[model samples]
Target: MAACVTQQNPDPSFTLSLSAVDGNLTLVQGEKKNITLHIERHGGFSEAVSLSLEKKGGGGLPSGVSYGFDPSVASGSNSTLSLEVSSGAPVGSYDLQIKGSASSKTQYAYLSLTVQEKPQPGSFSLTVNPSSRSLELPTSGSVTTTTEVGIVRNNFTDAVSLSLESSDGSALPAGISASFSPASSTADKSTLTLSVASTVQANTYSLRVKGTAGGTSKYAPFTLTLTAPPSPPPSGPANATLLRSYQWLQSSPEGDQPAVEAMFYRPRQFKSGVNIPDEEGHGSIDDAGAYQGWDVLTPPNGGKHGSVWQYSKPVFIRLTLNRDARLAVVWRADPSKVPNWLKNNWSEQGSVRIAGSDRRVFVKNFSAGQTVELGSVYDPGASISQNLETYWVLFGEKDGTPSPAPAQLGSPAAEPNKPCPQWVHDQYTTEVTMPNGSKRVLATWHPQVDPVYWCYFGHDHGSDPSLFKAGYKPAFGYIQDDLHTSGVLPEGHPGFKNYVWERDGYRWLFVHHFGTGAIGRVCRQFHSLQVAVANKSTGEIVADLHINTDFGPSTDNNTDLPLDATCPPEVPTPSQVANQSNGERKLHVYDGTQGSLNGYEPWRSDVPGNILGLNLGGLTFDTVNPITACKDPGCSSLMRIGTSTGETRLFAVATDPNGPALSIDASKAAATGEFYTDIYGKKLLSPSDPGAVRQYIKPGLRLEVRNERNTECFARDAFFMFYEGCALAADVPQAFMNIEGALSDKN
Candidate 1:
């Protein structure tokens, strides 16, 4: 027997033992409890000791009770044992064994756990002496309001803590704070004070006064009202009064005439008289004009027959002040009442001259209201009464066509000697016989004389003609080609043809066509031709056609058209090219191509996947597709226009692309801090800019495209057209052909 035992195995190399630091633990149902266990090593035992818990009876575990150890395998001197008792755990004492093993040797410790039913919580109620309180803050000082809070306890004596919070879970308004005399107290009552700083906004607030005792909480409603002090009176004279009115007499070729109609009114006064003259002389003076209020002063003619007296005359209203006073004048027009012709033809036409000064401040578009302060006028001693005159005038033609206004007394107009191109002076009128046997003037290269300049002609026709293709020969001139077939084929054919006509002592090219029903009833099926005029004798190009060829169906897309028929290579006029480097070149006109004349192009499509491509200043820009980028309601009516600066701007509606729709009264719109926003929802002008005035263009406003040279020369003679004529001045990058005509018949 191998020495038979050799003396009992030397005591195991090491011994592992376990003992519970806390032999007993009490846990309520659904509660978690922890116990500490002492894991000890004896006789040189050094290996990690595994720890576990088991019911003494050998059942998996007390029903609904789970156990875990901080260190399941313990190499330290102690371990933590956590036990979780579910709500459904058996309510009884459990004898558990904590086993610790090391190197296959095991040791055990005993633990006792008791699971008990949860105890009931004490109850309490909260109340306030007054449920609501109101306080007013001075303009520069804070205010305070107080309320008494009462706590009623039922089977509860523990201290109850008090806190205030917004009933809606939001933070208290700025500068507002709540405090209690005794923050946490067992007493039945406590004083609650709410302090508000002057900076606190005036409003009604709902607050909750919460009292918490352990896990039991109660709340009382507290209403807080804050009021702001009343505003002080304005510091200035009491009021203003109308002193007198007078008209200035001037002489015209037609004979002597009053420069303006002078009408007097008191505050809120309505006057009935022969204040306005009738254009057709069809109505009695009594039936001509009637005004209700003095707040808004309008042209005496009531905007009838497209005639505005102020356009031809200046009106002065004298005001007398008892003391020093500040005056403000505003210009407004009812959107619905504004004539469509005025809106379509004019950019800005109304203006007011500063009192006792020739300086005139132009008003915004009639549709867009404007306000200006006349500034404070000081009394020039008591002997002489304070008298001031407000001069008002309207610029533009009586027929609603844009024209230059006469220069004021002090400000001289632009130099009128700037001579126009020689060809412009030599051009003669060309007429064609119409079907009615009446001679229609087709090309009046030199029609009306410019109001400002003597040498410059006022009218010419060279621009996008898409809108007038169906009319009689355009104002310029054209040759018809009834021989061309009209139909839509793989190789497109022209439906209507127009050829170059002679003008400005040179053969001019002006080709525009509209598709007929036979070609395609769809507005998208159209053909156009791009043309340039060259001096027949010198082969020098007078106009260079620069338009996006991809805009529409061109000869390139239709093989039937002759490629060689296109305009020759551009050779800019010698003087015009030389002036460009000297910064003397003014306006440039890039003739629209046939494709650009098409009513429906890629940029105008409403399809979802199509991207927007804008042709601006001869350059193309790819912008976000309006169909997808437009998030505002009623986006379908949105329209975009390209600025000469190479930016594509948005309009509120397609029908009124020049300005925002006048949906609100002018006063109300200004009061609400509301203004127009571009397509990107950006404000066009910030009112905060010093001396900045906001202007808007009338919707459906027609644009008359004219070269800068003609506009500049004409503006020199008639100063008012300087602003109107140069509205599109920035669109020109170089001196090109002088084209003048409406961009669209409607909008």
Candidate 2:
């Protein structure tokens, strides 16, 4: 403990009183002023206290403010202060802290001081050049653009101080101006030109030069840039005018679709007057006439198959060239059989390869943030009767109920009361397939169901269209076709969306895809019915997934299916089909609700032979949160793990009692190996290592580790990474984890 020392009353509002009579504080700026500090002693007083003045919150010296003591300011008490005004200090008011150190103890005190400005001694001036003007340069020549910067100083007493600096480094002419003529700010009046040199370019340019007022000096920077004219493009094969593939956006109720109609044939590259058509499309095209629908083309009599018309817009190229340069136009029907054929080959009065790929215009609708320019290509060709009905293009963003505008039957009018009248309605029919040979005959507002709804159509995961492989493909597959319409809702098309196709036939499609890692191999005849789903490594069924579920012609048409699957007597009404399962969820053979209720269509595809479909007979998604730990009242399987063809994939789950996760396994060569997922989202298994306790695995990360024989071979198969889920699963980095010693023998 030390003895205490004291001074004037300790109230922050007033300056402390000092007892030392001679000790005084001074305020300094341009002039110094005397300040009277009261001195008052209180209890616990000790030896004489020393005094020193400092900036309110700093040392005795603060830029322009410093303390001057009578006896001289020191670190301890009893010292005097003499305030000195710094010459470089700016005019302003400032707080001065007065510190008193009594013996070894000290306290803080403060006072206010202000500095007044004094007029500077010397005078300075400045002058600018060519206020503003324009300069022109040759389109393809080297030109230097410059701005003349001038700094002038007239009235002066002290050597008018100045410096020449620039905002940017533009080329400047040498000693632009001298004392008498040219100007230089640092010493005397001077002028310099800032310049930008042009290469073989054609563009406008801007440049700015700065001139400083020399008297006291302040930074004044001007900013600008000079650009040379834009140069003409260089000539070369790479720079040559290449034919840009044309695009047409033909949509169904959903969006753009593919089409081929009576576009009068004309040589593609005719730079001269109206290019002539190679062959006029049949005049009855709009009437559903001709090969490649040439007969159905608009104004069938307007021109022949090869009529010529000048058009900057690209017309459809109905002809497709195969690897052998064989021009083909192919068309097909579910025919309920797989085959190797073409549309324009082997004829019987007329009939080429069955379901051959069709050569048509590529129509695409796009959103911003993505390239809108794209060209159509020769996917595949298909053969059809002299009269295959073509479809029209529709845009996705437009709003309106889709009007059924099937091509009007041309020459061959429909027979009275015919199921598919030749001229009655433009709608087409597709097959309602079942395991048995039984098929449901269908009629749709969209004639091109397969092509419109099933084909791959959209901006894809891939970046380049050229990377897409060309081939004949079946239209997208939907589980049920009741009230499903692209115009109403977006159904999952295998390619991207559900398109419209006119048919009792199959549309040969070519996919321009830069397919990546694994893809599920789709196949037909699962239970002898066409099916699609993830497959196991052994090429057997592993999942039963589906596109969308639709009710028969909606309330509008009411063209009921034999049975209403989407809205069955067994199930509840539409209002009851909430996220939860209501009514009796009796897994009926038809799910009770057979009528279409306009629902979603899922996307499923196999490389070649595996079917991608859902188990209409067995649908379950736990909407009441099956797992106590999940925190969600949804199906048990938070993640779906399934096999398709030779691999497994992952699928995000929805919160529905009828959907948890699809089960799959490709273990058998004969068995469809398809199964539903177990309702258990989180799995807690014992850790193999003593260092670890419980093992928590995400449902997605879990794989089929063993086959029926309990062999580990199937789970570790590396080829199965192509499964959709594999790409999304994260690889865990773990340490010190041990495995069962007993299994070591198998190694």
Candidate 3:
């Protein structure tokens, strides 16, 4: 049968073949080309076939190059093959294979592609003047810079289209925009304007300025450097100096008080160029044969005591040293050179006490050039940055024997005879030099001993410590004053007007003051305070309390009463009496609407049915209403009230478990309320002033109250105490219900 195999070959079934309509293809980078792909069917092959393009060598398509078929799946004979080469595609020859498959049968077509770089006309070249630019962006508003793009033409006439792009293929950064004047131009030069918004961040950027014409593109490298604007100048004075001088009364051996001595110590640097001439009975000669010692025992008629010595009209001297430095001062008080009156009543012996330490030193037989040295001006183990050295030289009878040598210079004084009480935790000692050069020592155990110290620590636990036992604590507290000013809206702003007083507008101003006098530490300690207002009826939080001040530390000190030596009887006394100088907050009372003249009208007092418009007179306290005094940290229950006039007061009231337990009794209001006393048992409010009242309630207590618009509001006024060894008690104190009407207010 094998020998008889003369059978002719039969036609194959379903044979598929593929071929390109065109021959080898050539394209420029970034160019797209399409060619027809013919699928030949043999022996009536009609089954659906899929088409795909792939590299013949088993590698990815050339970088940035891609290929696709118009009809990826084909039952027809013809299909279009589209090939695209990106501008960044590699310039090289590539071999690709077209694959076609159907019903487990496969066919292939070969393609040769050549990607070439776009041809350059060489007729024109692009050149940008100032290829690199640097600019400082402002904090607000926009800035613009310009550069000229020149086209060096060599027989090129077609208009050139100019454009810009990031060299790294990224979009321009936010806040940056660009424009080209004469966008498509035959002119030699075009202006390229780059605008930078304030919002743009500072950085360096690489960019390309492209000029395209006649299917050719020319690129010019450009660099953009942006820098942040310089910071604004400081608002306060620079290198301002402060000096304090002190005065002391001196008695003579004859019992005549005809002389007074003024003493102050400053850094030795300030002594340069200062000349104290030798005058009979006025100055003493030092070992160098110069009148280098301070004036001693001047007669009362010479000049008023305590007058700070200044090198210039307004310039004073001060020095700051580290805690480890020993503070010392030098002075020679020659009794023989005293004035005639002082000489007649004075003796050779003298007594003196250091200011902060109260360490006494005795002197005898003063010599012409004998310089006395007072030891360290601060106590041992003090943590102060600076010390105040004051010499109280008295010419009266000496009660102690003179030391063999003057007190050792720069040596720490002996421990004081009186030690701090054992119950005083974190018993620290600090020295304060007044604006008048008077020095005082403050200790936590006995802050009341120094007037300046008491102003900061006294009454810190509220008007009465017992009030804290009832579980009632202060929630929020602040001080406010009034400001009279005027301003007009600027052009392009809503409600623009010329010469309009701010007070005449629909909004009212809320001016809050913080820190005053020597209590500038208050500003430093409580730099920022958070406050919240809530709706008492539903216990819902409403608006947040906002004050328009930086709340930074204050530099105001005791400048008005420079020579006053008396300490205040209690807290808030001298501070309230002193001029208000510190931080201030000015806020406008308006609805949250922008650019509307009548925005604040809704909150005005003239508006009817507005809870904020209700007229609240002086607070009329109920004498019989008992209040609980908190004796421990965890007693529960507190009340607060805030008025439209910027006055806030805290209180604790008791009633049945439910039913409007804490609220202002409008029915019991009066034209003038009774005055309330402060923690020191001193009357702080006057009956005649019905606008507001003030009080400090408890330590570490926080209270919350509704805003001026709400009918119900509450607040707690408290101070924070910092004691190293004091820990909060675990047991809540028993409620004392007798202090029902005992409310505290702070204006």
Best by TM-score: 2
CA lDDT of each candidate?
0.35, 0.25, 0.34
User: TM-score for all predictions?
Assistant: 0.18, 0.21, 0.19
Worst 10 residues of 1 by lDDT: 1-10
Candidate 1 per-residue lDDT over residues 21-89, each given as its tens digit: 245455556777676777644334577878788875234788988989989998877888888999789
The whole-model C-alpha lDDT of candidate 1 against the native structure comes to 0.35
Error of 2 at 589 (Å): 25
lDDT of 2 by residue, 119-169 (tens): 344444332323222333345433333333333333443433333343354
User: Who wins the lDDT comparison?
Assistant: 1
The order by descending lDDT is 1, 3, 2
Q: Candidate 3 — worst ten consecutive residues by lDDT sum?
A: 492-501
Q: Model 3: runs farther than 4 Å from truth?
A: 1-122, 235-747
In candidate 1, clashing pairs total: 5
| Model 2 TM-score on a 0 to 1 scale | 0.21
